[model samples]
Target chain A: MKTLTPIEQLPLFTTQIKAFINWTRKNALWPLPFGTACCGIEYMAVVGSHYDISRLGAEVVRFSPRQADLLIVAGTITEKMAPVLRQIYEQMPEPKWVISMGVCASSGGFYRAYHTVQGIQSIVPVDAYVPGCPPTPEAVFQAVIKLQEKISKGDTPSQRLVAKKKMAELTSGNLENTGS
Target chain B: MEYHFQLVHQIKESLGDKAITSVETGIGNPFECVLVVRREDVRKIAEYLKGQRNFQYLMDICGVHYPNREQTLEAVYHFYNRDQKQRVRLKVPHKEGESVPSLTPVYKAANWFEREAFDMMGLKFEGHPDLTRILCHHQFVGHALRKDYPATQNQVCDAPEVFSFPPLPLNEDEDVLTNQRTLVNIGPSHPATHGTFRIYAELQGERIMRAKAEIGYLHRCFEKMAETHKYQQVIPYTDRLNYLSAPMNNAGYCRAVEKLIGIEIPARAQYIRVILNELSRIIDHLVCIGTTSVDMGALTTFWFCFRQRENVYELFEALCGNRMLTTITRVGGVYGDIDDEWKRRCTGVIKTLRETIDEVDRLLTNNKIWLNRMKGTGYVSQANAIDYGFTGPCLRAAGVDHDLRKAEPYYDYDRLEFDVPVFTDSDNFARYMVRMEEMRQSCRLVEQAIAKIPDGPIQVNDPKIVLPPKAEVYTNIEALMNHFMLVINGIQPPKGEIYSYTEAANGELGFYIVSDGTGYPYRVKVRPPCFPIYSSFEETITGGQIADAVATLGQFNVVAGELDR
Candidate 1:
């Protein structure tokens, strides 16, 4: 048997592992661009040369969902498109986060009518919401930073277990006053 | 004016009392000449007008619902004669279930327009091939543009089942070798399609055997909402249509209402409009060329173009408060005047854009790969182009000298000296060449506008249409009352209908507004150019390769915002 050092015995190794994992996750956020409308044009501006999204380490925008960790819903999602959005969310690997960009994705913006979904939150869980008709590239960058901050909190085996349990409870309709 | 009177006389003489019900010249307005015809005789009269009277171009076909009238639905048609530079409106009123003969046999462009009319107003066309819901989903319950439809009513629909492609028929010659063809779905959320446009292509190896384009995924019901919103309030909605060139839509709708109210804006406002509209054209062409190059595996040109686009966006931000969705124009005039600083910034941006375009042209014009990819792809005959009602650069690429700016001049376009570039070959490369030359012409127009802009008030002095200045409104009772009435009730044009067309970046962006002497518009129908251009996609890409289809779609530059609006 190997003997542990005093520092290792003090339970600092898990904390160090969590910090390293969180740092890597925060830095490399592969975004799946769910661009649909005018906000999609602004998203292109964010990915363009002047306000390059590569500065924040989110340059590789994957169109497919399986390889992505961040879903940027960048336009209005109509009623017919809701299931496709959910399917993309489910296809993304676990530990995924969503950033609802622009007012349409956040709360339907100026399109408050029959076909437009009220907000993307009705279809998928959103980690952050950027507000603008089609938000500027700077607003998109700020949203990326906010999402990084949220990601920096890190995840552990225990946290995953709690999340899975909570999801199960919610899906099973057993969410009876689990006090926050 | 003589031509307008002759058109009315000829139409009434040709179509006797059985076909022609009444003809009304717009009172106090010289532009509009409306002909009301019997519902059953619409197709015959349309053909007569096209064949005998040389009204070769069908500008728009839309429907208006009048709930309380004996005939509840009216289908309206706008036809333009290129030689005479004259336009006529045909209105056919019918009962709710009575069918109007389809115009698809006469003009193929009416395919999607008739579908839109059916989708919005529930007016059926008897002989139409595929008259299904176009701007709304198939599950939508009621016609949205009907006067009785509630603005707040929303229905929750079940998500559609996963699409299964129909099996392709086996060719008689190749049945033994290969029995199945592959079905490829390109978009609805693809980077290639630019927006929510879907193309389903049936491929035999590398060649696209058949392709069907499906739209309406981003249809936010703009026309329905326009009925409920006040006339001026619809400007923001127009911004979302063809969002890349929002100022053009803004200017088009405002000009239509201005014509209705018989208001000629100040010379300064018109010149400013010309400048902004030309700037929007440059921006739109930049995106079209940049994205086309990007799709063809060239990244450097995209970067250069987008950098220049950013500069143009900055100029727009300095002029208005927004970058992409700028609702800059108002009912009577523009939202603000261009100051010296804005002029300086615009000039700088135009210089940068010229330099960037020169660089892009040097890089891509003679590149062996670009020429090989673009030269012979997506060829359209002149007949097919006109049949599909192609306008703007698309029609120009097919060797048609049908630029509305030249044929039907509006807003001092006749005074401006700019060449309309045309090409004999109707391919992707020709379209690119036309757009490139158009960007140069737009730059020239902007320069001329800046040089020739007359100094005056940006807004008209009419308190009935334009709000008074803020300082005057704060101090003077008359100004305050005008401001209060304008804001509270909105601008009211006379009870009449006007069809106004502007040469937008895509094509002829027409706005047909029917005002009922009220704050809210009775019916507003937008003739978005992309609708017809997009309708021709399946025909364009049927025999091309899948890679060429993407390149051709980029050349077409169909903005889904306008196409599905």
Candidate 2:
């Protein structure tokens, strides 16, 4: 019995390693606030004295994307701001998750205008969504908890998209390479 | 008000047909007197008014679109005089392709306004130095504010903005290394920026040589979206303008619609409006001071102030279920009336707010570090302040002593007893002091309003303007039909335009509404107070240190929603 390499379509050892990695990530997710508009004020309340976000172990709020693992997009993503958001997302050292907070970021909210992006999902892969014009502080907390759950399960949307992309490349007329 | 007619006559005497064509002064119009100027004479008239007649403040320059008129677009200019307490409107009616003269040479504040007018309505100015799209993506094709542009046709642009600043000249004493100035871009998402505004600065050894701003990252098309919806439906959009004090925007918008429809809400509603607006002012000031301190690395002040801010937000949540975006005003009056518990909570929160403000005062008032960061940094003169269209506390801080509440009283502010805080230092610290004192004055006004509010109906009793009660609508046929028509067709104001302004948390929040006698408004232009405040930001921070820009920007309280809307 030869040793099974990772991504052999049935690597039990790889699954165990992935679970271990996800567990570590789930506990210490440093969040960066991509706050642009009104939802930013609500996010301030989240990190403020009343509803302190430190209890969830995600209290390390880094403004720079390089130091963050969870990007909490807290406002509207206009057309002029989309490329900046994309650059920020790409700059975060991989194994990152994005939580699209507020209806403005998730679906552009009531601002179906010429400047607003329809949803942030069109630009970055959002792992969770908090629904409100400016979501309450508790909704943001719920999103954090939900993101942790997704992290521990190793079923994040970004990972799923990567897997789908890998499978699409693998199935492109190279059946013997994987099926054999 | 007679001075307006006299001023028009004065202009007519001076320049006759070369300057102005006609004057609009009637008993029916509720706002300022209008002077219909010749299209080619905008710059000349503006210069004449500012240089000769003391119309120093260029308050707004906006484009109003009318499809059926022979001249499809009109560039409306609002000018104000601080010493005289006079505000006048100038109209330059022109076709789509016709070019009008730029008012930039007269008022330094006209640069951004003319750019905005161009970006929105495609109104070209002849002598504008660098007229470009100010509020839209560079790749945007059509002017979104025009009547023909589709409101929902959103274009997705993924290109990053490149910064280009006009270089400043090097001094004769500067060395070669100092002459090689480094250009640094601040942020659309930097921590010190506190909002989505990018500042391109040329720095020489941490001193800014030249600075410029490129905003519109939060331009959600507030005006374009307002035109697509009904009159009452636009209240929520206005609430997002300055989310810190949303009810103030609602009050401005609803009062504008009420004035257009000519419906007077009951005295109780008026009192409630005043109380709500004052509380919002207190909250806005607290947050502005708190956030500015946080941006400057003074963390304790943020905790002290935001704790009190949360108290006020809880008070707002008790009345309206939403915390931040409180769409709490209807067309005729408020969405809901206040109760004894809400009033008690208001007093309780104001008490806590005073304690917090005092605590913050004690912590930062004499701190040597805070003084070094704020005092004497970002100094602006009174002339530069008024020339750049500064208003509210910022203008008052510059020693102009102009408050819309005291100068042009609205919402029965003339009856209220309070002091307008004015500071002459005109620095970052002076602006902070003005805001702190303004909050205390607001508290005083709220206390008086609570004791003096009359007991009456909250909304107007007109079926055409205000909706009937739900119980009456369910029982009576006429009430049901009225409710159905009101909800279905919306309030149909006459085919006219009204410019209504109020003393908002930041400055004069004006609503310029043009109705086409239909459910949907033809065009809605919000004169956001933060617009001109930010247009002067480049000059305010030019000679200061990089950190001083952060301190001044935070104190300016330039809400991105209002600045780019």
Candidate 3:
């Protein structure tokens, strides 16, 4: 996959309009920082003057879930907080993505206690996982760029889920016809 | 000294002979008096302590579980006298199902502490107003802190709490005759709330008639997790408590462990610890003031303060590889030593932040909207502040010229020269001023500490506690065995309990550690300073504008990681 990326072959099945939409989206990704713990502080650091997230076109951090296209789960998510996170995700409009920031949000890190959720993937489908106890802002920026690449490719989690479902349906239909 | 002995005598005389069990003094713990009171006399003893002996500050109320004891549950009440610098712990041993008298009637601060005791330890407090689960979800089945409950048995509760206000009271001076108050639920995920904290505000027009905050959304169970891990492993967990000042928590926890083990870290380590702690405090105050200004619609202070904070974090990153949760301090000393380049970075950041603070002061100090909004709102008197367990800047803002650094003089605080700024207003603006002044003082402390620091080993030289040097481990056979033993066995001290506190950026962050002659802790309860302050927040803002409550909250710096745990 790393070798194939250098060649950068364009897919024949996509349209110019789709390409333009992805291009615009890849540039201007509004992130909602669902920051709750130590990673929240690092997320703020990413927005600080030193990191200057404005250069990446993801500077507009929307607090409301409705306004954001990307959800940055940038901290630990407890069991009590999982439902609220789900509700917020469901509140967002379509064509949304999630960056599970830090070790806590990705795999609960070292906090394997009663209240903490092991990983946010149990509830929310994640597009990227930034690995660090509290990932540096540079790491977060890298994750954002990686997410943009996926967005431009039209390879989203929801889109892939739908595609997988269609393939399963097609296979099941073939089996039924052959059996009959 | 007289009060400690008199406390037991007076309680026994007032509540009859059966009310008093026994009195123990300084059993390897810092508290002056550890009174074993009968279960029924909890409230009465609290009343006597507050009214007679001036133990106005109900420091904390925590419950401990001893599975093998005759009474499996014991509720511990910590009371502090500000003037005398004395602390008393009341131990009430009771059965699991038995309900002890609540301390809420005596100290208003006991409201959340008692609820948390019930939530975690399953010790019921009789007549605790609204004694449901506080930290855990409302539907949480078992007490998570109990020995029987599995540490990793996570429970899910999806239902949001149904917040209800009291029925509209009939008022003689009412302009309108009907019930017109509206309930506004502010947080849990909102940007104004720094973390996962919810405020249920009952508003009449723009005024908040009553407010109740729901916490525990970020309850990662630090205590339960601490008990499961080795003693040294808990330092990283401490970092999350007040993430704004991670090193302060590290220093506090290390100090507690050092006290328990009866080992003094080298003077050089102490100086370095002080420097790092003051640095963390500076950033903490900057973030608090900056964020508070941001909440008031000034965005420039956030940028200015965060810029300085990032610079400090860079210095921390240079010292230790990590930025935010830099578990830099170890059991005896610190992770690594700083060189001249690092010292230069520290002084440079300190100098730049002083100018940035001046800029913020110019923007905020005399602004009309700032004064009008913050001056007359969220007032807490000096006496009332103590009653509500307000510590650190919030306590100082109420005209209590008390600073733990000055009073207790931990580490090199005695050698440092700084003033504790006090304000008599006890309002939101006072809190802002206190924090600003504190940042200036913290800057001074860091500079002075850097000047006084002598060249020596960063880590303690003790072979039993700390690991052997890398070169020694690689070459010498004895050093290899020492390193192996230290790594595998961890730090094991004699069985004892100690409550060691340090002046954290927010307030007094106390660590109540119980070691059972092993590497792993028996029980660890963090006296999170923000917990009591956040508890009194609702009462402080009653009958004030909702805006004032929001401003007050930012000033309080209620870190949910510290508050919930």
lDDT of each: 0.86, 0.87, 0.88
User: What would the per-residue lDDT of candidate 3 be over residues B1-565, giving only the tens digit for each residue?
Assistant: 5766677777778899888778777544444687788898888888888998888998888889999998999998888887888888888999868999888888889899989998999989888888989999988998999999999898887867788976876786876735478889987998889789999999888898888889999999999999998888899999999998999999999999988898889889999899989889988888888778888998888988899988888898898998888999999899889888888888998899899888889988999988987897888878779888989999999999889999888888999999999998999899899988988998899999999898888878888888887998999999999988877888997787777888998888888888899889999999999999999888888888888888888888899889886
Give one digit per residue, the lDDT tens place, for model 2 in B254-354.
98888888777788889888988998998899889888988878898998888888888887788788887788888877878888888888888778778
Chain B alone, TM-score of each model?
Answer: 0.96, 0.96, 0.96
Model 1 segments more than 4 A misplaced: A1-15, A155-180, B1-15, B26-32, B161-173
**TM-score of every prediction relative to native:** 0.93, 0.94, 0.94
Best-first order by lDDT: 3, 2, 1
Query: Tens-digit lDDT track for model 2 on A18-87?
Result: 6787788888989999999999989999999899998888888899999998999999999999999999
Worst 10 residues of 3 chain B by lDDT: B23-32
Q: Global CA lDDT of candidate 3, please?
A: 0.88
lDDT of 1 by residue, B60-98 (tens): 999998888999899999887777666678999999889
lDDT score for candidate 1 against the true structure: 0.86
- Candidate whose DockQ is highest: 2
- DockQ-based CAPRI category assigned to the predicted complex of candidate 1: medium
Q: After superposition, how far is residue B379 of candidate 2 from its true place, in Å?
A: 1.2
Q: List pairs with backbone clashes in candidate 3.
A: none
